[model samples]
Target: MIQAKAPGKLYIAGEYAVTEPGYKSVLIAVDRFVTATIEDTDTECGSIHSKALHKDQVSFVRKEDKIVISDIDHAKQLKYITQAIEVFEQYVNSKNITLRHFNITIDSDLDDASGQKYGLGSSAAVLVSVLKALNEFYHMQLSNLYIYKLAVIANMKLQSLSSCGDIAVSVYTGWLVYSTFDHEWVKEQIITSTVDEVLIKNWPGLHIEPLQAPEHMKVLIGWTGSPASSHHLVSEVKRLKSDPNIFGHFLKSSQLNVEKLIQAFKTNHIEGVLDSIRKNREVIQYLDAFATVDIETPDLKKLCAIGEKYDGASKTSGAGGGDCGITIVKNDLNRENIYNEWSKNNIKPLRFSIYHGQ
Candidate 1:
């Protein structure tokens, strides 16, 4: 059996901006991971088990020379798995290599005890994990960029629009500055083009660069006890972006803050980073009010206020509404107080580190 793990991710800055080409976002892969185990089997059909999805076993059989889901319920829940199988199978087949039947197991530590997702990019992590396992199992010799591209394609096939910054962070761990491919261009290619053609296509605006975090800083993640659907929030943000009046202001402010934060990271300036975070939070607040979108929920606002009381800066991490908020704490600050404050508000403080694995 071959096993692979991919870490879940959080966006530190550039939430809505990354959806557009030429804008940069800072993403960090957290400690939580989705693990996929693949093993060759002799049953002529493949089976899958997912601890996170609560499926004991689901079968996939070769039909019409294509691997497809044979279980109804698993088909709905394990779209990420089946799509990955289809994509990888197609790629390997093109090389004149016949894929063998395999049993795959997926497990994730990214969810809460009650199975609520923490908006840690579980779907992207799952895709990355499964693709990485297949890459290793088949000895595909896929480069890091190729692995990232495959995951993004699979995500686009499953979900209509995706920045894929999460996929990149999972493939290349640690802190990163990420800019997305043009969403419209990617979507158009996926709709009108074949996978092979798209694979070799030049993605003009996409960029991913590794970044180092400051040594004297600490990050705290607090889950708001409610999972926000990134799909829903992103859709609303897209609609809001059409209004030049609202989105135009948001884009400029967000880009400025992100640029400042990155510069601070380069110089190891803690205060500069914290200052930009505060300004970024203000930008989000203004956007929420101007657009009447719930980018920052009441709980998230409360979370930020708590962090402010302790001389730390905090903001909702991604496509807001709920899920987790990130707080930037200096090393000298008392983290216990921040943790307790979040606990009192029914928020769970997650113990996480930047991903250290490739």
Candidate 2:
């Protein structure tokens, strides 16, 4: 059997504005992961199993160059898996390789045992893991960028509104400053070009740069019990783009703050990093007021407030209606007080560290 794992991610800055091409965001991959394992099957049909889903395995067959799940109801649940398989198979077909039946088992630690999501980019991790497993199984020796492009293609089929920073972090697996590609350009290219052609060409405005965190800085994560729908919040924020004055201001401010954060990392200025985090939080707060979408919930407010009390800079992590909020502090600060305060406020202090890629 062949196995692959992809790490979950937390956005440090640049949330809503990062959807635009050339806009940059910072994120770190966490140690929690989604893993995929592939094994050859004797039968003509292949199956997919995930403990998070149903007890029974879902069977599928390749017909007319598509992977069709046997059980229609579960098809939607397993869309990411099937989509990754189809896109990877397209690349394999380009190389004139015949496919074989295989069974895939998916395991994830991104959520609680009771199935409560921590908003850790489980979907992106799942797609990356599946593609990685398939790449290894076929001995493709594909580059990380190639795998990321394939994952993006598969992901866009399911959700077009995403910035796909999660997908990039999953594939690269470390601290990163990511800029989104031109979504409209990729959408147009998908209709006209083969997967191989698209992979070989330059994706306009997309950039991923790895960063080294300063030794004096520390990162902390707090999870609010309430789950958030990133899609809904992002969609509401997208509406603001129609009025360029409000949206443009948001984009400019977010870009400035993210650039400051990136530079702070490069210079080993821990104070500069903390200041940027605080400013980024203010930027998001301004966005919340203009968009009328509550990106930061009450619990998230409490979470950040507690972090600030301990002399750390804190802010909502992702699209943040209520999921995870990040805090950055100096090494001398005591994190236990912050964690205990979060616990007292019903916020769970997640115990994972930054995942440096294996």
Candidate 3:
């Protein structure tokens, strides 16, 4: 048997802008992970079981043309897994190798006690884990970049639109500055593209660079006690996308701040990071006004205000109607007061960092 695990991701900077090509996002790989285990089986068919997805004994078989999962319920929910297997089959077939039947087990630590997702990229983590496990199990000799691109394809197959920045951070498992692939180009090729065609294409616009948090930096994650629908919020944001003058300004400002944040990390400039985050918060606040959506809720604003009171910077982490927000402080700062204050307001601090492997 072989096992592989991948960490969930958080957006330190660049939330919405990263979706567009040429824009960058700063991402962190959190310790919470999705794990996959694979074991060869004598049966002609293969099977998958996921504890986190509440799926058991889902079966599949390889046909002359393609692999097919038998249970429709499992098939729908297991798109990433099924598509991964298909992609792996294609990869191995090109090498004139027949894949073996196996039983796969999947699990995750990205959920709460009640199984509510924490807006962490659980799907991306699971996809990365499954891809990594298969690559190791079959000795496919695939590069991490190739695995990342394949995972993005699987994710985009289900959701049509993605930056794939999450997949990059999960695969690399650390802090990174990611620029979007030419998703526009990928969308155009989908009508006549194979995995090889897509994979071989040069995405000059895509970039992923690793970085480290400044030694003086400390981050505290807080959950807003509710999960927000990222799809809905992204759709609402898209509506105003047609207004080039307004949205373009938002894009330019957001991109600049994210770049500044990266520069801050590189130079160990504490105030630069805080200032960039503050400017970023303002830009998103303008975005909420333009879209007429509550991207940053009152509770999130309260959290930021508290952080400011403690001489720190705070903002929503993702598409933020509610999921999680983070407070950035000095390493020597007192967290007890901040924790107490957040608890009183019903915000739960999530103890997480870049892939520490708990």
Candidate 4:
């Protein structure tokens, strides 16, 4: 049996703009994770079981290099898992390794006990975990970069607009400054090049750098009790591409503020970090106003206000119609106060620490 897990992630800064190639974002892997366990099967067929998805096991088989799930009705629910299997199979085949049937089980802590998502990049984590398990099962000894590339390709197969910074955080597992690769370039290369060639080649504009959080800094997360669809909000933001001025300003300003935030982290400048956070929040607000999209809900606004009142820098974490907000503070007292205020406003404070992968 082989078991592997990948952590969920939160966007600390750079959300709407990071989708564009070369635009940067900062993210942290959280303690919450999606775990995948695999066991070899003696039969020709295998099954997939996920606690977060279906209640029963879904049978599957390989059909001419593709994994086909028997339960069509629930197959879509396991798209990430199946897509990961397909991509991993490509890599395994490239190595001349013959695949065998296996039963894979998935468990997730990226959500509540009642199974509500926290918008913590659950799908990305799932794909990473599945790939990790397969990597071990085949003794592929794949590098993190290889697994990340495969995960990105699998994700792009489903959602073309994704920045895939979440996958980077999941695969690398720490605080990271990430920039998107040119998706069009990868998509085009995938058609003409083998998976091995694509993995070995340089991905234009892609970057991932790890960072150490300052000892004096504390990160606080508050849930708005309302889950937002990142895809929907991102797609809405994409519509603004029709207007070059507004969208261009959003991209440029977001890049600048994110760069400032990254520099502050590198220099251990807490004040600079806070200022950049505030500025980045303003940039997102500008985007909200012009795009006429609800990036920040009323609860998120209250959450940030309380954080600022307590002298902590705060903002909505992701695409943010409603999900989680992050608050960065210098001390525990301010964090406690922000949590108290969040509780008073019906916001749930998630006690998740930064997850550094083993």
Clashes of 2: 0
Q: Which stretches of candidate 4 lie over 4 Å from their true place?
A: none
Candidates 3 and 4, the one with greater lDDT = 4
Q: What is the lDDT of candidate 2?
A: 0.93
TM-score of each: 0.96, 0.98, 0.96, 0.98
List model 1 lDDT by residue over 202-267, tens digit each.
887999999888887988899898888788877878888778978888888888999999999999
Q: For candidate 4, lDDT tens digit of each residue in 69-176? A: 988987889899999999999988988999989999999999987778899999999999999999999998999999999999899889897899999999999899
Model 2 residue 31 CA deviation (Å) reads 0.6
- Whose TM-score is higher: candidate 1's or candidate 2's? 2
Weakest 10 consecutive residues of candidate 4 by summed lDDT: 50-59
Tell me the spans in candidate 1 whose CA falls farther than 4 Å from its real position.
191-194
Residue 146 deviation, candidate 3, in Å?
Answer: 0.7
Error of 4 at 235 (Å): 1.2
Using lDDT as the measure, the top candidate is 2
Measured over all alpha carbons after superposition, the RMSD of each candidate to the real structure, in angstroms, is 1.5, 0.9, 1.7, 1.0
Model 4 deviation from the true structure expressed as Cα RMSD, one decimal place: 1.0
**Tens-place lDDT digits, model 2, residues 1-358:** 9999999999999998899999999999999999999999999899999765644798999997799988898888999999999999999999999898999999899997778899999999999999999999999999999999999999998889999999999999889999999999998888899999989999999999999999967899999988899999999999989999988999999999999999999999999999999999999998899766689999999999999999999999999999999889898456999999999999999988999999
Model 3 Cα lDDT, one tens digit per residue, 157-242: 67855678889989987888999877767766644677767777777689989888788688888898889888888888778889
